[model samples]
Target chain A: MARVLIVEDEMLVAMLIEDVIVDLGHEVVGPAMRLETALEVVEAENVDFAILDINLAGKQSFPVADRLADLGVPFIFASGYGAAGLNERHRQAQVVQKPFAPDQIASLLERL
Target chain B: MILQNDTPNIDPFRFLGKDGEAAEIIRTYDWSSTPLGRVEEWPPCLRTSTALLLQSPVPIVMLWGEEGVMIYNDAYSVFAGSRHPALFGSNVREGWAEIVDFNDNVMKVGLAGGTLAYRDQELTLHRKGFPEQVWMDLDYSPVLDEEGKPAGVIAIVVETTERVLAERRNREEYERLQNLFSQAPTFMAMTSGPEHTFEMVNPEYQTLVGDRQVVGKTLVDAMPEIAKQGYLDLMDDVFKTGKTVRRAAERVMFARTKDAPLVERYVDFVYQPIRDERGAVVSIFTQGSDVTERVRAENHQKLLINELNHRVKNTLTSIQSIVTQTLRGVQTREEASKAITNRILALSRAHNVLTAENWDGAELRAMVVSSLEAFQVESREAIRINGPDLRVGPHAAMSIALALHELATNAAKYGALSFSDGSVDVSWQLLGDKFELDWIERDGPTVVPGDRKGFGSRLLLQVLPLELQGTATIDYRPDGVAFNFATSLEAVNDRPALEGV
Candidate 1:
């Protein structure tokens, strides 16, 4: 089972995604709710993979994505605006729009 | 008087050239009936001049002495239109009857040993059996007799009608283009050469640059800031490549006057290159419209749409969380369904409160009243809610609304509302930077504390304080359940949702 990290700001969304990740037979890392916290988790943990929300409160999570890329950890972005919201650097990365089904997350985890 | 028959043996008309129609016309004409009499009596100057003009290709006509009699060659016949053979020996005044006075001036000037010339002279003539307007370049010089005295006027006529009319049409077309350039709604400018000198600037273009006198000045000279913004480079690229450059909704900074502050504006523009006949770039034509207001409105709309999408997605996830946890806690499908509807309704009611405030912030009193609206109305009067006028940010307001719903739900089920005489007191205040709120139940059934770690208790004890970045507690008192919450005022009145994103 892969150790997946969740970086989402919405409290229930984070919890719901955490539940989904655990149900997919994977160990869960931080469901970091802020950019700084996500970056800290990426630096401190032996993360195998990550699911990043594009927005954190009023801030963007691109810096977290950058840190994850630097650590050679693969990740996908989850956002309400979908892939259109990603900047130039991360535009080609995988994206899963919010209000996602558990099965969508499960299939993505299997691919990871 | 000289006689033509006496000179017939000498062949007096021998000087007339053997080629052209004018030579035959002169030979067969009855010149003896005119004042100059016959060809044998003609002066040597007239004979020599007529012969010389007849062989020449230019249109030439000579008027002999006294009555100014007309003599011309083949070329002049075409210039005469249809008034040819009938005009051979006719007097100059009656030959071109429409311009009799104009020819009269020419006759008097030439016979007096003076010369006259007119370029593109406009005149009316009936050469075609009808009056027609024409233009000609006419030159008149006196032809002297053998005695070196003024004798007759020799004239050369060149019709300039076609050229004059073409020039007039060209001028009219140029004026029409000038009018369009001046009145166009879009700004337009022409800059020439590598210096990008502004050669032409219409009124709309003038207004775009705050009516600056930009004509004849290089773009860098008139607006150095624009050059710094890299528009000068763009123009140079277009000039060198002879290609067109288009930009849309691009930001530019401008100041109305030298002392004024720079204001940001957006524009949609094109730079088109003008080429010479050799296909070399010579000038850049710039045309565009100031689109600051349109761009700003579009940006605001995009922000609103994104904000709306984010909120909707988050609210759906909140409902998802409610449904999943509710189903896990309930004993039956009926109980789960009722609890899911109630939770979603609570969330929807909170959204209404936030929407009323445009999602900026909500009044604490409004949140309190709306959250308790679903409870038993007979018990609403018993629920005392007292708080100073306070505004909480959208996230804080939504969390507090849900937390209050949970507490009231518990009160209606087993606390204050379950007993008719029971009542609840809810109050909040701000002291310095810290905020404090209290919900105390009195005169209710004795509360039985249970280790119920359900969705409602989790929201009250965990999510509310975590979201608000503060502390919250619920005490199962023997009389009722009491809940107290405290956080910083800044956390309660946080920045509006969707700001800076």
Candidate 2:
């Protein structure tokens, strides 16, 4: 099992997502609730892949997504808007529609 | 051959109906220079034809004998264009030298026992002082003597210059309108009949549909894809009812390349019926514009709202998960469930305030009332809310709401709200960029400071500071419990405070 970074703003949502990650036998890194913290964790933590909430609080998680892409880290976008909400640069990136179950995260991680 | 003295006494002059100015001119004309001798000397066929020509209501002329001299009616004087009285007995070549070549054809045909007629013939005639253009309908027929031989050419002329020019102008105007119709910027098409055949389409439509063979083809025949998307039905409905149809934005999948995926597009369009003079629908004018970009931007905004809604739903799910997970790790289920339900209810109250303002934020006064409103005493005097209105973002509002709910719950159970003499004053102040809220309880049961790490203690003393990105402290005195919290105003919603009393 690999360590995964969880970037979600809603505290309970972030916790539940961490629970799902732990349930899948993976060590979770910073479940950052904001874009700045997510970027800092992505830079500081030794993580294999990232689970990015497209909207981190009021700001977009695009900088974190872009930073992860620059570092050649595989990541999946978790958004309620599905793939259409993504920009042209991340159009082909893996997407997990929001309010996802633990197995969907596991499967996405497996694919990554 | 001059007929000055024998003008009114001659057989043809006196024998025929010598009415009108043309007859007077002819009876007195000097014909010595022309081939015709005189009115009295003209052959019987010529004399009889001259009388008919003079009495004609329409313009008429006679070019008689081998020399082809002119003799015309008064009506013909107008067609002669100022070549009137002098032209009555002048040679046709000498009088109308400008169009003599045309007259030569007429004379050659008429005198050779062939009739020649021209309708609305355009010719320039030398008349008055200038060579003028004129259109005329002319008929030339040969007249025969008693021996049945072709004697002279009789011409029936009617100038139609005004009518011809008017018709030309009308045709030119029609052509100009046609030019505009073909090149208009907006997509335009005219479809006729139940089949909605494309009667005409402009260049915009041609390019829009990828230059498909649309004109002279039915709508379904031209583009079969629209039939599946209810477009065919809509068009049929509009045509049958003659009612206009306008779609603000419709998504269409256009297949631009073979074997490739359908390209999605958005368009705003209208179908307007064109009626005939009888008020019957003859065709439909289809006009529209591509609105894909605007529609996409609108959908993006909708997605953002939907994401917010999803977050709300997910928060509810998370609360459920918390309650269920806490049940597995708790000492008393009833107390834990009660506390969880109460906290969740407070969060919902905060959400209600935020929802009312389109999720932008919630006011602190409203948030306070919503959090403690459920634990209300019989009299409103038990609780005093005094604060300048503060709007805080959803995260901070939720934290503040839960903190107040916990404090109020503790007061109701053990501090102030449990007794009739109890009262709680909730107040807040904004100093520079710092926002601070205070809760003071009085005239209640004696406070017993506990060292236990209960859910209420952890929630009130720790969660408020952590959640709102602020700080909080609680003090227990002999009379009641008091709490004070401070946070950055910027972290809360940034709206002007309502004037407070």
Candidate 3:
């Protein structure tokens, strides 16, 4: 089982993500919702993969994404606005539209 | 004096008596008797009745008693044809049956002892041997006898077909030019001589002048200032050189009426010399149009686009701040979930501000008032706001709104708004294109930002710059937390306040 990190502002979404990861036979790490807290988690914990929300509350999670990249951790993005909303430089990163099925999430994680 | 042979032939020479008698009669007779002699000398065959016609270019016919419309010596006998033998003794009517009515009219007028003159008359006559349609201006005068009674009629006729046709063609061309001038859309005028005196003006030209008399007057006499400004000089140059001078897209300002606003116009004109037959320049023609409204509209549209760009940039910055601050507030799993929802709702509210102005910009005080409404309802006395009427762009509004939310959340949880004794003061001042806003807390529960970094601190320090392109400072005073923000005025005014939200 892989250790996965959930960086999302919404408690329900984070929980749903946690459930999806657990169902996938993966261990869940801290679901750091804010940028500062998420960065802290990335630095302290050994995260195998991460699921990041483009916007956490009012703040973007780009800093967390940047830190994850530096740590050589693979991650995917989940946004209500879809892939077009992401900047061009980060567009290559995998993204899942919101209101996604569990299997879709599982499939994306498997690819990653 | 009948020098003819002693034969039975009736000698016409008896009518003249003898050579000396005929010579004496001719000498005493008035050579200047006919009115035609005033403009033209009589031809040598004027007194003949046999068939005398003068026809160098213009055919002239003179008929005397018993000559049957005798033509001058130069007149062709073909005009008489088969009737030539009988024409010597016959009257004009019997000799030329086709011209009987015309002959009768002239004969009647001559018989009444009056001169008959027809300026232009069309006549088809079988003269000599050929039939031809001839236009003639004829004058018939009677020669009186000794008792002052009519005896014989003398005809003076000039063919005028060529002159009449030429005059008709000239009139038609002049009418066509007038029609074109009247229908022209641009203002057109003609000025005479180097003095540039207005000679003629079209309807559009009259309308453009608007209450100014522009005919038969020099430009200086009509508008002294316009003449002084080298307008006359241009006309003078065209006249002197006999060359056309064209002025294209020249800007000019004029008042429509005495009390009307000055209107700007663009004029395109040509001053060409109107030369006489001698090829000397005499006048100049000018034409032009007015284009003020179109030019003004183009400039106004450009300004509106620039204003739109400024507002959009500010809005993006505000959204950035809201997202950053909301995420900072999320602590536990439950709070993190709630914070995201609240932040999105706040962002939607800001979007409403954008929509109100159709995304142009927003009001300053309104943005602050709306953002604090949620926090204000829970605690009335805890908040105090002070600022004059102001406007902010969308970016500034969003940043300020998110920043205020953070302060209020913290105050409600552990700072000033947490207790009845605590209070918060929000005040702002304008400084050029930027506004300085201060949020100070007083009489609150023992003040401290928890040692661990919180969402409020991160928003006040780091997120403001990333989002608003602005700066925010927070002072951890023992009394409370004091926060100051400096941002662009465009950001504050670009996002108008949301209504009914």
Candidate 4:
């Protein structure tokens, strides 16, 4: 089982994702809420894979994504604004929209 | 025919009496101090010419003898400004000290048998309290003595000050109006003739037209971009019929920016006909303003508002998903109602946490506490939670809230919370590249695994792991129930996009 990290800001949405992670039988790392917090977690924690919210408290999480990329950790972006809202550097990364099925996240995690 | 001054037949008042006003002034003037000392001693030629000057309606002054002593008529007095009655017998030099040089020139020329004339000779004279400007057309003719020698000069003066000043003021006013037109904040242009040739365009209009040469060129030749745009036609229509045409706003492309691709601008304008005497339309007047920025800002706001509506609709759909999932595979109506209501409340509670943070995220500790608080499991230390300060995203927060509510309800009914002394310990730790959370129950009834999969079991075994991109397990130990959940940090922390409405 792979360890997964969740970085989103909405509590309800994060919880739904957690329920799915648990069922997938993989170890869970963190659901970082702020970009700075996510960056710190990526630095201090042994995170094998990560899920980044394109926005963290209205701030872009690209820096955290960059740190995760440097360490060879796998990750995907999820945002309400979609791929068009992502920075040019990450426009091609995996993305899932809101109100998504748990299976969508599961399938992506399996690929990672 | 020459008459001597002493001739009995000659009349002393003969030459002076012909002009009533001049005759009165010269008869009364005191001339005892100088050459041609008195009126009776004046030379015969001087007297005759002075009489002729008096009768003439034009302003004239007759200066006789070496001193050029002045003798003038009523018209001459008015042209002399304020130096009138006092100057009747005074020398020309004394009366016209301000323009003595000019008068000196005239005297020298006239006495040498040369005629002198000047048109619009300008001078500044302190005639009143302040200096007054004056212009005149002057003519000086020499009058000979009885011996035919040059003796005196007759000056004909016509003041043109009022006319010159009026003309000057008219030119100044025209220039002032031109200044206002160029400096005005709006675009202005004047087109004449049927072809709508540009007669005039102010600086504001020039800037709006960019690098194009507008003035002296027809509308199409100057701003060809607007030829088919109907602006030239509008000017033509207004010019041909003396009618006014006004447009509130029109999008026109003037290629205002110096680039290959042109930019369109919205302008509010009016074209009016200028009519001369007899009401014939002479020219077309156009005025306009650029409204591009204001219109674009308004359109951008509308776009943002539409996006906001779509986002709100997506959030509502998320609520629908929670409600739909909770009602699945329920036994009784009462059971179903309880389950659905409790799940919705769980979702709402998570929503509340996210709302407090502007839907950014929530604290994991806070999410756990608030989610289980609905069941009163934490009262009297019945439940314990252990973890560092970890933040949870909105998506995870909502799912976990419902999952936690389901877990607590199961514990209350069949596990640790079913008995008074029973307790539940919820703790989490970060493993290498993985996050682990455990829910262990203790001191309750003997635990047995459920043979059939219920909604809660399906969520724990299937839905939860799928949503988190991780794994979870339930152990039906004889003492109590224990559930351990783990997932990758990346999966849980990832952002989600908003689905379209």
**Highest lDDT model number:** 1
Chain B superposition TM-score per model: 0.76, 0.54, 0.56, 0.65
- Candidate 1 Cα outliers beyond 4 Å, as residue runs: A1-7, A14-52, A64-78, A81-112, B2-5, B27-41, B63-69, B91-93, B129-133, B145-149, B167-312, B353-368, B376-392, B421-452, B475-482, B495-497
Fnat per model, in the order shown: 0.41, 0.13, 0.00, 0.08
The local lDDT score (0 to 100) that residue A87 gets in candidate 3 is 66
TM-score of each: 0.73, 0.55, 0.49, 0.57
Quote the B-chain TM-score, candidate 3: 0.56
lDDT of 3 by residue, B1-501 (tens): 234344548643233233432234333444344332311233323333212223232334445433334333223233344554445334577777889887877777786777888876877876646777667688887755456676557666676767877777898888887777777898889888768889888888877666688788998887565666687677777878998887766666565577777656666677767889999988888877655556556656764564444334333433443444445445676776676666667666766775786644567677777777777746365688899887665556656777787788788787877777788899999888887899999987667556434555655575564345457787878778888888766544432222211
Chain A TM-score per model, please list them: 0.96, 0.94, 0.93, 0.93
Candidate 1, B1-501: lDDT as tens digits? 456655657666789856669998998899988776777778788889999899889999998786789999899999998999899999988887878888888888999999999999999888898888889999999999888988999999898989998988998988998888899899899999998999998887777778567888998998888888998999999988998999999999876577888878888999999999999999999999999899998998998898788778777777887887778788999988988898889888988998998888899999988988778455257788999999988777878888888899889888987888888999999999999889999989888865456777777776677567689988988889999999999878866757764
Q: For model 4, what TM-score does chain A reach?
A: 0.93
Q: How far does residue A67 in candidate 2 sit from its true spot (Å)? A: 1.8
Poorly placed runs, candidate 3 (over 4 Å): A1-112, B1-58, B63-103, B120-135, B144-149, B259-261, B277-279, B305-501
Weakest 10 consecutive residues, lDDT, candidate 2 chain B?
A: B492-501
Candidate 4: clashing residue pairs, number = 89
DockQ of each candidate relative to the true complex: 0.36, 0.09, 0.02, 0.06
By TM-score, how accurate is candidate 1?
A: 0.73
Which runs of model 2 end up more than 4 angstroms from their true locations?
A: A1-5, A18-31, A44-50, A72-78, A82-84, A89-112, B1-38, B42-169, B172-305, B308-312, B325-333, B414-423, B440-467, B473-482, B494-501
Model 2, CA-based lDDT: 0.77
